[model samples]
Structures are given as structure tokens and as C-alpha cells.
Target: MKLLVVLVSFLAACKAQNPEPCTSPALLSGQLTLATQNEQLWAFARYLYDALGQRIRLQEMGFYQNKSFTYDALLLYREGVMYEINNQESTCKKRALRADFHPMAVPRNASLMGQAVLGSSSGPGQGVLVNTWTGHLPDNARYLVTVTEFGCIPISTSYRTQPFGWMVTSFFNNVIGISDPNQLNPPGFCQDALHEEPIDFFSLFHMMK
Candidate 1:
């Protein structure tokens, strides 16, 4: 009954979107550029990566505040690829909004930098979110990067490959104990991250040194 109540409350508290007709496809096409100079994207990049400083431990639940709402994110990796589930919340911000819908599969010591356009099928010829994300990892870095939820705010949609925007301007508070087979299963554990308050990526960067 408690679980049912949470689900019911989530459905009621959350505002669902009635999407208008999609006039076009949400097409994003671009090459991976590690050092591309797209000013807007770089700004987002700086914000997301904490200027290449925030540190995250595998399986650790991290929260970032933006627009008075908190985003729940988990940054974990195994073998060589980095796994990220940017928006993971329940009973709040459960609009199923996703950022980085495709888990950024960054290789160890390599960067996952690319330019892409998020299009609106309903908004023909109009790119909903336009930006590039450039991230570099230390040779020994365990986590991929950090985000402020809507940190790299993009022109958005309520539904997309990665979902967001125009749907309640969501706020999420719960950042742990959700069901993901991959949760905390990796080369390392997130006990350290859970024990300490999330530090600015800058401080995390220093820890790497």
C-alpha cells in the first residue's frame, strides 16, 4: 500500500504533458570533437564538469541543485566504459525525463566530447536543444563527469530520446534505493560518495591530484 501510495502521489503531483503535433524529427547529428569551440556548449561543459573538477565515485548517488530543484544522478563505470543515469528520481520529477538518454560510453582515459542537435518532431526544422559536451578524464579517473540536472539547459521537449522540458519544470529529491540491475555494481563502490556531501567538481578534481 505504501508503494501504491507513492506511485499514486507521484502520478498526481507530477504534471504530465499533452504534446502538440511534432512537426519534425528530433535529429541530432555531429562528429565527436574534443576541442571544438562552440561557446554555448563550452559554457554548459564548464558548468557540467565543474570546470573539470568535480569528483564522483562509482555507485555513488550525487545531487546537483539548479533552479531550486535537485537532480539525482549516478556516475559509475566498469572495465573501460563509463555509465551514467542522469535523472533517477521517484515520487518527484518522475515525469521520466532523461538527459544523456544514451548512457555516455566514455572509455577510460578518453574523452566523450561531441556536438549534437536535439530536435522537436512537433517543431519542424527547429532544434529543441543545441549544444556540445566536451569532457576529459584523468588517466586514473573513476567517474565520468557531473551535471546540474538541467545544468546544460537545452531547448527541450516533454518526450524525446532523452526526456525533459515543458513538463512541470520538475523537481526531484530522492536520490537513492531505486531499482537498477547495474546500481552500485562495478569496479568500485560508492560508500565514499554516500558518506561525504557532494563537493564541487573543482574539489573533486583536486582529490584526483
Candidate 2:
């Protein structure tokens, strides 16, 4: 009887160490900062993500080659369209986005790197448990991401792409819901934007430079 009890306890401990994967909330708003290690590019943005609606909007300021510019991008994945509005130039460009909406969830093939507490574990309401995972995208890009263990809120992600080298993106000041539902809509000026040829989303980074 004592051996059986020990075996059950050991199984419970192992389960706790390797919890099941979790999906993040469908709607969220946050601040995002992205930087490239191999390029002279840095960007900051306020983002609204609606996974259920298959849309995302980013009001971004980017610095490249000592020039700073601001733009707003609305990606409508369900419609396979993306609108890029240049706040400085008062111009808008529309292009086809052939990518599908990728939820902020751990991929089925991801390998868990480990788990750690961000603050003092003994302190009440102080520490946050986080899980780290590494995986590869279908396009052959590799990524390492860390998310909160409870809600699966993303903390940071580092990805390496063939053309751009390595880039790191951090998410913070996030809340569970979109503050303004209309924030996802493209500006009125985009109504007249001409549709351009389809291009990979990563190509925008190259254009920014």
C-alpha cells in the first residue's frame, strides 16, 4: 500500500512539472517593442489583437537609418488584406496578405525549455510563473518565446529569419480586452489606397529600412 501511494505522488509531481499547453485570450491590447540585431531598425507600437476576428492593428513608430517615421497598419487576415497608412505622408497602401492568423499559443511541436518565477516566490502576489518554449515556423524561421504560465500572456519572443537575421519583440502593458473596438478599423484615408501586389509581411521590415 505504501509503494502505491508513493507511485501516485511521483506521477502527480511529474504532471505539475510538465503542464499542458495553454492558449492566450482572443482579444488583447498591449505595447510592443521590436529590434533587429543585424539591422539598424527599432520599432515601438501600440497594438490591438483580435484573434477571433482574425485582425490586428498596430500604430507604430519606427527608426531606421537615423530616420524616424510613424505608420498604422491594419491586417485583416480573414480577408487576406493589409493596409499600411503612413501618418507622416498622409498616404495609404493596400496589399494582399496571404498569411493566416496565428494565435498566440504554444505550437504542438514546441519543446519546453523550462519554467521560472520572475519574482520572489515566497512573496505574496509578487512572483509570476513563466514558461519558455522553442519552435520553428513553417517558413524555416526559428523562434523562442516566453509566456506567463497562468494566462499564456506573451512576454517576449526572439525569432531568426533568413533575410533579416535575428529580431526580438517584447510585449508589455497588456490587458485582456481591446480598449476600443473601432481601433481595428482602417483610417478613412485608406479607403482610396490602391491595392498593390501581394508580398510577404516580413518584407515590410525591409521597406522600412
Residue pairs with backbone overlap in model 2:
none
The C-alpha lDDT values of all candidates are: 0.26, 0.86
Error of 1 at 103 (Å): 19
For model 1, the superposed segments whose C-alpha errors exceed 4 Å read 1-126, 129-180, 186-202
How do the residues 1-209 of candidate 2 rate in per-residue lDDT, one tens digit apiece?
99999999999999887855678899999999999887677999999999999899988889976788676788999988999877667788999997778988888788889999988799889999999999888888889989998889999999987665798999999999997998688777788989998867787776664
Q: Model 1 over residues 1-209: C-alpha lDDT tens digits?
A: 99999998788666442111111112211111111112111101111111111222222212222212222333321222232333332221111112222222222333333334445546666643332223333333222231122223322211111112112112122232223433333223322222233333223212221
Which number leads on lDDT?
Answer: 2
**Weakest lDDT window of 10 consecutive positions for candidate 1:** 40-49
lDDT of 2 at 111: 88
User: Worst lDDT window (10 residues) for model 2?
Assistant: 200-209
Q: What is the TM-score of each candidate against the true structure?
A: 0.17, 0.89
